[model samples]
Target: MTEPILPRIRPEIAALAPYKQGRQAGPDAFKLSSNENPFDPLPSVVSALQSATPINRYPDAAATRLRERLASRYGVGSDQVHVASGSVAILYQLVQAVASVGDEVIYAWRSFEAYPGLPLVAGATGIPVPLTEDSRHDLDAMADAVTERTRAILVCTPNNPTGPIVTSAEFEAFVARVPADVLIILDEAYAEFVTAEDAVDGLAERVYEQHPNVVVLRTFSKAYGLAGLRVGYAIGHTAVLNAARATGIPLSVTAAAETAALASLDAEAELLQRVAVLVERRTTVIAALRAQGWDVPDSQANFVWLPTGERTDEVAAVFLDADIVVRPFSGDGIRISVGEHESVEKVLQAAQSVVERRQ
Candidate 1:
């Protein structure tokens, strides 16, 4: 009998647990786990999709037209924009382009879970700097963590998990200290949700004009109500954009996705109005949670974070029992995405019930 043969895999890959997404528990479950737009797609965008045909043909490999549109909007040439399947894909490509085996990539701890994994997958080391006490990115600490072997640093504005933003001044100072060769990726997936005056613009207009090393990542997923469509892009130096494109898989972005993204850009005003509504709801939810004595951080993103620590699981369970799906970060915190009015009310009620029972 031949000995049982098992396929060998990378130790990190074998040890990693699959990423879990928020599940729709039932038909009536109020899902506030994944930070998605609660609004429907704009009529113009919908019509554009309906009009699109020939799904048989492959998508434009370069995403040329879409890149042109983005470039014009951002006041850059076509060479500066690199569209991808989504911002996450662009992020992965960035890691691969800049990081080599044993190089270090630094980012804030608990900002984006994918941050740590992206560098690891590129055969690079990740150095996660701890967040500040107020749950914002500690840019000072992150800048300090950069060393001779550091190749890249990722900063998530209106950061995931905590949702606070890094100020423009803070970001500027941090970038000044980082080595010119080290690429700085400013992941602005939640940029549209921010309303603060000091929030980093993330278009890379100011930063890129002065510092060629900074790259800004944005997506049509959240504000554009195109999460399912999977379209995002990177704005940076033409050189960095070219490097990212070099590592990109051929035909990674589908035709439908490109159509949706272009249409969404045309409907930007309407989508921003919906984002305003979400911001209002986020404010309401955060205030309510704080009133209930929860340690809620000041979030500029579409979601709110409650640092319940070990109680996170229990809180999530309570919401689940109430048919409201929330995301709990094991022993770290619980994140609830702000949704439509009724869904927001349901979350509040479920939270109240849980807190009352605990009291």
Candidate 2:
């Protein structure tokens, strides 16, 4: 039976499909559906969370200390750093602050799946530029797509699902073409997993310093294994960030999250060693997939892209039956994350079996 429809709901929001999270696997399966850090929580981080205070009170509204730490690390003032529950939340705030009815937000399609839905809720149109044949962003095409109606542009490095990164040269050139008034967001959620030397590091490169309109979004969720805590930060001009801050859900950040982030910072070295392992696993996955005759993209991030195209669903199911869960963009491809060390052989075995069937 058809569900009853609500009256007077915003048509755009009603039409928008909900953002999908990756599937979870059974206890016997390795869950590689989400690009999550496979390591268990560090002992120090756990201890810090256990030491939280003032459960009766709210968290720091501004996330003052976290912002200050980030600012110092990035060589920016505290005012220039903005922290939110997650980078995705910061994306929503930035979108609502800049785009509205009749405004347009441009980004590469098959990028972050969340990019399209963000503008819809903001009452803005989302323009999705097609990715190139190699599944990398067509920066030139994106620059050409910009118009007076364009309010913001999001560039994802080592882009989600598809693992290619935007080169520093292309990014610099694209920034040159974008109008100064249009807000540009570099969503580097997977920067820590990036091993390619040529890939643009949005925060480390400090693109925001030269372009006042640019903002960089990053999250500890991926590298630090803090997805459950949900903390992320942004670096940009204070004026632009203030606009996002105004749209922010007040006191949404928690003391536990702030403390956890601080503890993660303290444990950065150990966490990065884990990232290095994932990177090696990613390399092995790519090599194995290629040997199986699958044309995997050059993934600098922690995931590999299998452009299964029309076979996406079938291929995903094969992996599922083999006790491995993965994210499949139906009719397009599959995104298999580099997960636990034990999962490596399982993933390759599943992929090889699927490849044999195809052949």
lDDT of each: 0.88, 0.92
Residue 303 CA error for candidate 2 (Å)?
Answer: 0.8
Candidate 1: tens digits of C-alpha lDDT, residues 197-297: 99888684458768899999999999898999889998889999899999999898888788888888887888888898899889889998888888888
lDDT of 2 at 225: 96
Off by over 4 Å in 1: 1-3
Cα TM-score of candidate 1: 0.97
Model 2 misplaced stretches (Cα beyond 4 Å): 1-7
Output the worst ten-in-a-row residue range by lDDT, candidate 2: 50-59
For candidate 2, write residues 140-225 as lDDT tens digits: 99999999999999999888889999999999999999999999999999999887888998788888989999999999999999
Per-candidate RMSD, Å: 1.5, 1.6
Task: Write down the RMSD of candidate 2 (Cα, Å).
Answer: 1.6
